[model samples]
Target: MTITENAPAGAATGADGVEHVDVLVIGAGVSGIDAGHHLRERFPDKTFAILEKMPGRGGTWWTHRFPGARSDSDLFTYGYAHKPWRGPSIATSEEITNYLDEVIEEDDLKAAIRYRHEVTAASWSSSDHRWTLDVLRGDTGETVRMTCDFLWMCQGYYNHQDPYRPEWPGMEDFRGVIVHPQTWPEDLDWEGKRVVVIGSGATAATVVPAMAEKAAHVTMLQRTPTFVAAVPKTHELAVQLRALDIPEDWTHEILRRAYIEQFNELTRMCLETPEEARQFLLGEMRPYLPEGYDVEKDFNPGYRPWQQRIAVVPDGDIFTAIKEGRASVVTDTIDTFTETGIRTSSGQELEADIVVSATGFNLSALGDIPFTVDDEPVDVSQAVTWRGIMISGIPNMAYVFGYFRHSWTLRADLVSDLVCRLLAHMEAKGATTVTPTLRPEDADMEIRPWSDPENFNSGYVMRSQHKMFKQGDRAPWTHMHEYAEERHTLPAADLDDGSLQYR
Candidate 1:
């Protein structure tokens, strides 16, 4: 199974020239770093390189620079399974990036990564049994060619260049500066200014309280309420473990399991008893707000708990800001942008010097890279996901799409193991490629959305559903399972199953 250093013996080369490897992993974020570690550990004889479009590592963490940008999920599970997170459960972007830096350094993955290589187009040739990639170097204006036997897509699920911002009437008439959290300006100042944050998602929840500290006043304007819960920055048990002089790795493993069990129970409760779960969430939120605040008006969501995602505020910081009169919440649709502020449908004028649009982002399928199989373009929407890792009709390629309800890295780590196992299986079978194909018996299986709207319908997912791959109603083709289910199913999944065609 040993592969040559730069050029595999059987791989093809382009006319100009091309570099070839056994595996080419896309992105240098959490998932890519994990993939690097697995490849080095399990298959030292194989040659692979990681490609990243940005100038540095940390895909999402590096891209998001807005005020108060942090992880909404607890770091215990969000952190890589092999690494120990010693910081607070909810960490800032800088802290997360530093953690990634340590992982890259400790695992000797820095030399295997190319910082400015961006894959623009990929074409697969069945005869050659290889993939030729067209990569544009961000550092230079030139495009380079490369080839690989296997492609691992870990570029993330969202479009980092553009964010979703709704068009409101009279936007041109407004004189205030409008900013989107995705592209937060470096020189913009909000101190001593009237600030208004639009939308009630995680971004808005993080920005409002952070800006309220210095802004003359801040208003969180939302069309509808979102379920919000307050969580401690540091887990109580983690502190106790440190007090006992327990080893860091021991503490990490114990807390990781504890958090996973706790979240699994919460998710199950939300699914089985919607009313009770909703009541419990609301009850938890009530103690954080002012004694007589109208929780029903500003905090109660139209949907049940975990319908989309519950925004987590560290130490009830957002509520504390509201209780101190530094910030306020107004739930109403925008009528139009006034000369200096925004006007609500209720005829109330909310004046502001600056506005932050914390609307969601756009989903990118396979990093929006154009693909061709033997000169035929690939429309990803028409295909079905195979075990939520490989797509039907796509050969020698597997992608990392994480869970929406849980920490993304949970699924990322699981998929890494599955991909490594599949690679080993292929090598043992002496196969050049493997593709997911629908059997004749599966012809009549119902095709459903990638994620069922009933289970979790976030705005970004619903807005981009038509562009995502489809899922079948049968085994090995469906992926709407929870982390607890996937943790077991993915590892024990039969690689010899008929759904995967080996050549």
Candidate 2:
């Protein structure tokens, strides 16, 4: 690792030819964009640059090219707090990327972003109060170094390059094409082919109906059922607000708040009266299914409502495909992969020409980047998160990990606000470094998993729990709270509460 002298603020290069900035943001995704916007708007004198691993902006949207790729959360809450989302509630990846493009162009953020630059390792020097990042340029194999006073990690929580694909029995013997949604092949044709999608999550819910459009038949094979709700493609209130000629910003805020309230109410209902919430969720899908279709066998989940994420089917399109006989659902465990297709444990063989593993993604801890503090390697999983943003023992670094029950961007925006506030506070104190430290009172606090499995047990979270940071039983140490609570608590969080050590 190359160490250089810390350059003054706003200086692009230091004496040793190392590029330096006030802040270095990792990833140009949703969180990164929001961070960039807030830093520019709140602190115009600060120099920062967004380093994106992909060749362009729209991190996940640009990376995921699977059919029917869209957001499970409504765009109103999923979009940036500053930008107005004028599109429908459920939007495709294209629409999302387009909206992100508008934000990039309108804010003149193109110049501040360096695309195709991936950060391999980040080393922080306490002596100099700066972070040195070893970045690799994708277009060229050459490696470059950049230093920053503060590191804003917005690379998201999942591995974009390597998705979680389980090795099934006889996968090598399968003659049909097997594809994972994260890395969809551009030239692989699925039209007029029998397709079988494994897993019943949002990706499967989206892909099944989409492939059914031209595929001979699409089968959604799942080991267990998931709570699926049919939401309107366009929100009713959004239509009314637009009809009244309300300004875009006003509509965005109104819809954003409305969705937050609705989500909170549903969450409360699920927690307080789980049986009623379960029945209600199941009842909502009954009308969308074909007559005589066994909803309990396929749509009814084993767990209570909100235990995991509920997949939202826009306008009941997946159900419509099932009703039209273009697609079908099979709830069973896979025995093995035959030369033709998958053979379920029930001894039934379903032949297919293509198989899509819409299972899930591997959770990436801090973009899977190696880190070092004062030349000593740091293991992130051993550290605890401070307000779900900064990690314990790491100085001048903050990450954006969003809420699972609500839209990810909602917390992203909140974190941006908190980070900006923290930066301003640091400036006011004339402190060059700030770290979330364990207080004397916190030493005895119970250390828990990053998220309580009982509260939210999504497959991705459960499978990767060992790789995530831990949370404590106290305030500012816990991070898995709902957005309804954090929306206020985060803004009002005391920075000088002795939880953070500054110098």
Candidate 3:
């Protein structure tokens, strides 16, 4: 897909010197970059631009400058379907950022991006059939107005500013330095100093092995256990194919399909027989642990597999660190923070010179951008998502939210495809707008949480439940994590399903 030099005719310019385009994509992350490429290919005549809040590209990778920062999912599927990732399965933060930069450079997307331009609010105009956005310039305390035919929210779901850190008594009394992984200090020096990492998620798992290389000792303090698994650097089939001199792109595609298929079956197993799935997952980890190790106590989680994200360690680095006496796991609740250490509820005092809280992030949607419809403020919590992309009563707008079970970009790719179809259909019918509205028969349909609470028990998601959009109990209204179901349904979905109202 090549970028066209010309902008579409009759592009709207708002009252406050607004710059308009055919589409306004709100982010320069993976989703934003993916959407840009698809739009260029699907609608070559239309013009669009990406607004990035950060000074650089790579939304999550750029912002998160923590030590041992890397992807929990493999690069093959986590990567865009259009792009081929030639690196190892698990890539570091810097590596991922560089990959994004490569995409931006090769695809000529840099010209279409405006860094440090944060979109503050977006209001839909019914009369003009457009969206007027209020964007704040990062360098200056000024607002830049913009108008668009459609708004694409490629911003991922997570709060960047404030991460979730629970208050503990005597935290002020702790003499050791406290750090959160989200805001890791650049000049931090922990060499030969005792370190305590809190939480049991992927962040904690990654940091422990990484910091153990320099720190005197690293202790992973967790209130509850999480499912941790080891993944190889490359798929066996890809490795075999490469050995036989198969082309890189072809090998990557083979591996990508294999991973997707494996995960799709795993997702089905989780939904169908959760207990069996949990046992199978634990069984995979048993061989990595020391003899007589309590897999149930340390490796097993309370919830079923895929409910919360499963943590993946590249080549079992964390386990190696523990086995070699460089790191250890302490399963207990923190009673209080003492001057030089933390006291546990079990009356154990763990000495530490530095404490890192890998607690979790605050979940936010549309980059927390305020939205309005026809000059009226839109309450996202009351809105229902149409196939996890378009929201009910929202005109010519779509948000790219990925699958929680599989690699995020898998669903993003599908959403981008559907969006292109929607835009093309609108053009063919001479329609200026398309909005998913609840039908009369759907008035009494039971409204539930966006995801089933039992199947999604992540602390960050549960805490921010009130802020997320709701979903219906039926088809086209539910947000599914199953890639197989979405892969087949979304691309062939009926445009005139009595939900999407066009004008």
How many clashes does the backbone of model 2 have? 0
Q: Which residue pairs show collisions in model 1?
A: none
lDDT of 2 by residue, 195-276 (tens): 9999999999999999999999999999999999899999999999999999999999999999999999999999999999
- Clash count for each candidate, listed in order shown: 0, 0, 0
Report the lDDT of model 2 for residue 474.
Answer: 91
Q: List candidate 2 stretches off by more than 4 Å.
A: 1-11
Q: List the residue pairs that clash in candidate 3.
A: none
Global lDDT scores for all candidate models: 0.91, 0.92, 0.88
RMSD of 1: 2.3
Which is the winner by TM-score between candidate 1 and candidate 3? 1
lDDT of 3 by residue, 1-503 (tens): 22233323334444555678899899898899999889888887788888999898887888787778999988899988878888888999898988888888777788888888998989999999989899898989799788899999998887888899898988999999999988889999999999999999999999999999999999999999999988885667767887898887887798899888888888889889999999999998877777777889888888888899989999888988888889989999999999998999999999999999999999987788899998899998999989899999899999998878789999889999999999999999899999999988888889999767787889988898898899997777888657888899999999988899989
TM-score, cand. 2: 0.97
Candidate 3 Cα misplacement greater than 4 A, ranges: 1-16
Estimate the overall C-alpha local distance difference test score of candidate 3.
0.88
Write the residue-wise lDDT of candidate 1 on 1-36 in tens digits: 233343323334445467788899999988898898
Candidate 2 at 113: error in angstroms? 0.6
> What 10-residue stretch in candidate 1 is worst by lDDT?
1-10
